[model samples]
Target: MSKKTVFKTASLTFLLTLIFSGIAFGQNWQTDFQKSLQTAKAEDKPIILVFSGSDWCAPCMKLENEIWSSDEFKNYSAGHFVLYKADFPRKKKNQPDTEQVKANKELAEKYNQKGFFPLVVVLDENGKVLGETGYKKLSPDEYIKHLETFVN
Candidate 1:
C-alpha cells in the first residue's frame, strides 16, 4: 500500500475502535437494580445507585469524569458496592433496550427521581434506604469519604 493509503486505513480503524469501545463502556453504566441487589447479596456489599444524565447534565458529567471514572473511585467502588445507574436524561438518549429503559423508569419512580441531575441513592441488599446525597463537585478523596459513610 502507498504511504497515504496506510495512513487512512489506520485512522479509520482507530475511529471505529473508539466508537465501539465507547458504546461498550457506556453500556456498563445502565444496570438492573434487581441484578445489582443479587450481586450485592452474594458479595455482602451495599448498593450504590447513581442517578445521572449521562449525555447532557453538567454536574452528572463532572462526577463521572472527575470522580466515578477515576482510578481512585473505581478502585474503591469496585469491591464495596453493587453499583447501579438510573439515567433520566432531558431526552431518553442512552439507546438502551426497551426492557432496560422501562425498568430504569420504574426505578426512577421508586427512587423518587425528581428531574434532578446527579442524585445519589445508597441502598442495602434488601433495598433499605441507607441514605441519599447529591454531588455538584467532588474530588476523589471527597467522594471516597462520602461513599464510605454509606457503605461502611
Candidate 2:
C-alpha cells in the first residue's frame, strides 16, 4: 500500500479499536445506592449490589479482578443491571465521605448482616432482595450465570 493509504488504514484501525474497547470495558458502577436505585427503576433492570472492603479484603480484590473487571461482565452488566458498590476501604485516602459510609453501613445491616467482605446481593428495582452470594472460583461467563439465577 502507498504511505498515505497505510497511514489512513492505521488511523482507522486505531480509532475503531478505541471505540470497541471502550464499549467492552464501560461498566458504570454507581457509588451512590439511591442513584443506582433510581437508574434501576427507570431502566427496569435488576440491581447488583456489591459490598467490598477494597483495601483490606483479599477475596474482594480477587473478585474485582476476576469478575467485575472482566470484559464479559462489563459488557453484559451494562445492559442488564444497575451496579452499586458499597465499598469499605481501609486506606485513609480511599475512604469515602461520612454520609456514604453511613449509607453503606445501613445497606450492610439490611443485606450483609454477617459482614462478608465480598458479598454480592441481587435486588429488584424496588429494593427487594433476590439473592445473595460471595466470591466464587468461576470464569466470567460462569459468574454471570450465577448472578442471573438471582434475577430469573
Candidate 3:
C-alpha cells in the first residue's frame, strides 16, 4: 500500500475504535418487555435482554466488540430469540426519549432492581423469567455456545 493510503487506513481504524469506544461502552439496552412477550408469542422463541454499561464500562464494550459484532453473533441472534436492550450509561448525553427511559425503569424494577450493568436476562414467551446472568469473559467460540440456547 502507498504511504498516504496506509496513513488513511490507520486514521480510519483509529476513528472507528474511538467512536465505538464511546457509544459502544455501556450499551443502552432497549426495554420492550411487552414487545418481547409479543415477539416471543408470535415466533415461539425466548427473549434475551442485554443491559450494559455502553459508554464507560470496559468489559461491556469488550463483549460488544469481541462477541456481538461478529457475523456469528448476528447470524445466531437472527430468526431466533427476541433481543431487548436495557442500558444504563455513566455518560450518555443524547439518550433515548422519556417513554423509553420509563420503560427501562419498569423493566429494571420487574427484574427486582438487581439491575446492574451487563445484566443479561432470558424470558419465556409469556414473559416469565427464564434466567438472568451478569457478564462473562466468553471467547467467540464460547460465546457461540452460549448463544446456542437462545437460538431455535
On TM-score, the leading prediction is 2
Tens-place lDDT per residue, model 2, 1-152, is 99999999999999999989778877998988888889999999999999999999999999999999998999999899999999999899999999999999999999999999899999999999999999999999999999999998
List lDDT for all candidates, in order.
Answer: 0.77, 0.94, 0.71
Give the Cα error of residue 14 in candidate 3, in Å.
31
lDDT of 1 by residue, 5-107 (tens): 9999999999999976654343234377778888888889888888788888888888888987876666667656678887766565565777877987898
Residue-level lDDT of model 3, residues 31-126, one tens digit each, is 667867887898887787777778887877887888777555655565556778776666569466778878877888887476577777777888
lDDT score, candidate 3, position 67: 75
Taking all chains together, the TM-score of candidate 1 against the true structure is 0.75
Model 1 has an lDDT value of: 0.77
Per-residue error at 151 for model 1, in Å? 3.2
Regions of candidate 2 where Cα sits further than 4 Å from its true position: 1-21
Question: For every model in order, what is the number of clashing pairs?
Answer: 0, 0, 11
Q: Could you say which candidate leads in lDDT?
A: 2
lDDT of 1 at 107: 81
